[model samples]
Target: MALLSDGHFHSGETIAQQVGLSRTAVAGHISQLSDWGLDVFKVKGKGYRLERGFSLLNAESIKKHLGNTKRAMIDVESVLPSTNTEMKKRIANARHELADGDAIFAEIQTAGRGRHGRTWLAPIGGSLTFSMYWSFPDGYQSMAGLSLMVGLAVCEALKDFGVDDAELKWPNDIYLQGKKLAGILIEVEGQIGATAHSVIGIGLNVCVPDSQYDVGQPHSDLTSYLGHTPDRNSLAAAIIKSLWTLLPKFTQQGFGPFAPHWEALDLYADKRIVLQMGEKRFSGIDRGVDASGALLVETQDGITRFHGGEVSLRGNR
Candidate 1:
């Protein structure tokens, strides 16, 4: 798989010889790659190649970009059901050795998830799918605005990588020209009075191919704006580093310092919008988010605050 990851075709006989596998066995492996959402192209005599050339995530490259930070344990997986799930299992097993800033990156996620039980579609090498474990001394209630802070971190990281137009959409989405470029899911497990542990999952589209997959909403990838794909390792490192730097301040100062920046990058601020909670809906003008990161919407009747869980927002359109 690494050999063909360069997006060039290699003959099955050559691949078999290189991997010391029978040609028939190699064919079986190729078939399984499709199940991982990797687009493998097989030509009559040329052998197999990826639909496009992409570099696999390199942990060292990510660390190098991170630079002189706390010793962050980085795990890179070629395929996983979900990085968030993997991190949770580790925590469940009482892996106390795992500290804040530890992260996992997956090349392809077969069962990646989003808010509202949506499937997170991450084609191999087409998107950045990863999760980081962050711990706060404060309890879960004190982390009310944490997701909004993370959204700001993502926007700052995108700007660092020369992606200037990325904007924040309410609670946990980053958008480019109103199309979603990234989404975030935060899951925490901790007792009421104890320190909170959050598994922050992020899925940022990098180079999704034009295909028939229904994403269920307008979406955009970095390739659409940058005219070329950015290195996944570099992008991942930027995001991780940004979050690492921000988490401590967030724990200390809460969301106050980040409020101005969040509003600056807000996609729907002061615009007509709709908020949905289950079957209930409210239309209002976006007043941006409050100090606690609850969305502030000024409806015809009065102002309403909507938190992250079980709520969705849409533009007037």
Candidate 2:
């Protein structure tokens, strides 16, 4: 796994020969890779190799960087169909199986999803696809601006990677130079009378090149935008650490403590902008977000605050 993760692929024969296993066994393993949601290619003459290799997400590597947070609850997978979907399934089965701060990470996700029912494109070795599973004691209603808070964590994590210019575009999109570089998707699953379980999914463009931005519009990657890519293990560790530190506060203070930081990084702050909310479109000056994490827009009618749901904030023409 480590050798494969170093950014190259080996044929079934090579892998089997190196590991002293039968080629048939190696072929079986390659076939089973898809079960973990990994896309593996098999060429009769050339053998099998990953389209692109990603630093394999391993428990020990991540846990080492995690330090004390490792005990908080973590699940690292080499590959997963979708971390968010997997967490949702786990939460449905039994919340107790995973702790309040549980997180799931994958090197490559075959079926990742984004907000507004959009499919998230996580080309092999291009980005980070991970989901943090959290159980909020105060319930979903109490943490009204939870998604915004998660966005704040993402912004902080990026800054730690030396991308201090990164900005947040409302709800939960990370941007650099007016282009999207990452996104956050929050899914809440709560029992009728029980606490709310949240799966905070973050898709970060770590090392994707400009040429690979076909799936989404005006997207940039941290490595391409920053000139160098930080070690994936280090970046993942920093993000997880910040998230673990902030989750407890978010549950307690909601978005109160994070409002200032979020406001500082608002991409559309104090600028005349257009907001797309479903079929209705409104033009307003971005007055920054409110205490509850809702976007406050100074419009022709007055100041309007929006909470969530397909709200697009863009600079006014």
Give the winner by lDDT.
Answer: 1
Tens-digit lDDT track for model 2 on 202-308?
99988767774586688888878778767777788888888888888888878878888899988988999988888999898889888899999998799999888
**What is the TM-score of candidate 2?**
0.87
lDDT score for candidate 1 against the true structure: 0.88
Candidate 1 regions with alpha-carbon error over 4 angstroms = 210-213
For candidate 2, the lDDT comes to 0.80
TM-score of each: 0.96, 0.87
> Looking at model 1, how many pairs of residues clash?
0
Model 2 Cα RMSD, 1 decimal: 3.1
Q: Locate the minimum summed-lDDT window of 10 residues in model 2.
A: 1-10
